[model samples]
Target: MIGPATPEGTLFEGRVHHMSIERLLAFSGGPFTLNHWPARNLHIDPEKAAEAGFPAPVASGLQAQGHIIRLLIDLLGDAWSRTGSFHSRFRRPVFAGDSIQAKARLAARRAEAGVTQYTFDVWCERHDGEIAVVGTAACTVHEPNPGVQAA
Candidate 1:
C-alpha cells in the first residue's frame, strides 16, 4: 500500500508523509576495528582518516544512503524496492559518536504509464541538526496521487 500524497498549496502537504529516524549505527565516537584493511585510509581508522585530512574516522556514505532507503520505504511502502531511486550528496562526515537522523519532505509527484512517481526532499541530519547528507528520492507505485497533477 502506498502512503498519502501531499496536496499542493497546503501546509500539511509535506507532513502527510512525514518520517524521521532517531539514530542509525549509534556507536560511541571511538576507534573501530576492521581486520582486513586496518588503518588503510578508511573511516574506521582514525590515523588514516587524520592523514587524509579528516579529524576522525568517518562513516561510509553508503551507510547514510541505507538510512535514506529505509526512510523512503517507510514513507511509501514495501513496493518501493522495485522502482525507488536516489540521488544523494555527502555534505558532511559522520563521526562515530554523532547521532544521525533521517528526515524527508514530499516534493513532487507525477504519473507514468500506470504507476505514479513521487519525489521527496530527503536528508540525514546530525543530532546537532546539521545536514550530513542531502538528496532527492523517487518511488513509483500503483496508487493514485491525490491533489497532485501528474505532469
Candidate 2:
C-alpha cells in the first residue's frame, strides 16, 4: 500500500509554469488544435485567432487538468501511485499562448482502521490572472502499519 500524501493541512502552493507553443505541442503529442477540442478543430490561424480577440487558439480544458495533476504527482510522489482521485470543473478558457499555475490547500484528514484520508482544495489559474478551474480532491494514504495501530 502507498503512504500518506502528507500529515494533512499541509498546504501545497505552486506558481504557474508557462507552456510555450513548442512545449504545449510536445506535451500534447500532436499537432496544434484551433477548435474547442474533444470534437472539432476550427483550424484558426494565429492572425485570425488574434483578430478574433483571443491571443491564440484556446487550449483544451483537459490540458490544464493534466498539468495540475503532473504538479501534484511530482510533489506527492508515490503517495498518489494508487490512492487518489481528482475532480475538477473548467471555469474559463485558457488560450495556448497564455501561462498558467496551480495551487492546492490541504483541507482535512481522517484516519480509519489503517488508512488515512485527505481532502484538498485545488485550483488552476491563467497567467493573466483568470481562474480557469476549481475543484476538490480526495486521497487515501497507506496505513502507518498494516499490522500496527497508533498507540
Candidate 3:
C-alpha cells in the first residue's frame, strides 16, 4: 500500500504510475451512449468507426480521464478524493483495442492555509507512444496531527 505523501516538494517528482488496461466494449445503456444511436461509433461496430475515419471504435475521452484519476488515487489515496482537482484535454483518439497507461510528474508545490498542496503534470499514453490525454492535477495532502497531550 502507498504511504502518505511527504512534504510539498519532496514527493512524486518524475514519478510514473501505470493504469490497468480496460477493453472498450459496447454497453447497451452506458454513459454518453444512452439514447444516442450515433454514439455506437464508440464500441459496437468497427465498420462504422472506419467510416468515421477512425481505425477502430474509439473509446470515450472520459475513459482516459478515469485512468489518470485512478493513478492519482493510487498514489494519494483518500487525500486525492477529498481535495484533488484536474483538467484534461483529449489529444488523440483512443481505439477500442488500444492499450493505455497514465503517467505523471510533480510540477510544483506550495503551503497554503496549513495544507501542503501539490501540482502534477499528468497524461495518458497509448502503447504506441501516442498521447491520448494531457492534464494537470492539484491536491492537498494534509499532515498528520501530532498526538501531544497537555503536560
TM-score of each: 0.68, 0.69, 0.70
Please give the RMSD of candidate 2 to the true structure.
Answer: 6.5
| Native-to-model Cα distance after best TM-score fit, residue 17 in candidate 2, in Å | 0.9
Question: Which of candidates 2 and 3 reaches a greater lDDT?
Answer: 3
Q: State, as a TM-score between 0 and 1, how close model 3 is to the true structure.
A: 0.70
Cα lDDT tens digits for candidate 3, 36-87: 6434453546787788887767777887778788777766667887789999
Error of 2 at 37 (Å): 17
Preferred candidate (lDDT higher): 1 or 3: 3
Extract clashing residue pairs from model 2. 16-101
Q: In candidate 1, what are the lDDT values of residues 1-151, reduced to their tens digit?
A: 2344455322111111111111222222233454442334445666867888887667777776677777676556655667788899999877656777777777776766667777878888877777888988787777653422321
Candidate 2 lDDT by residue in tens digits, 1-151: 1235445566665666765655555554344473643232312245645766766766667778777776566555556657768889999877766788887777787777777777778888888888898888776666553432221
lDDT on C-alpha atoms for all candidate structures: 0.62, 0.65, 0.66
Q: Which stretches of candidate 2 lie over 4 Å from their true place?
A: 1-9, 29-55, 144-151
TM-score attained by model 1: 0.68
What local lDDT does model 1 show for residue 29? Answer: 28
Worst 10 residues of 3 by lDDT: 13-22
Pairs that clash in candidate 1:
29-97
- Show model 1 residue runs off by greater than 4 Å: 1-39, 111-114, 144-151
The TM-score measured for candidate 2 stands at: 0.69
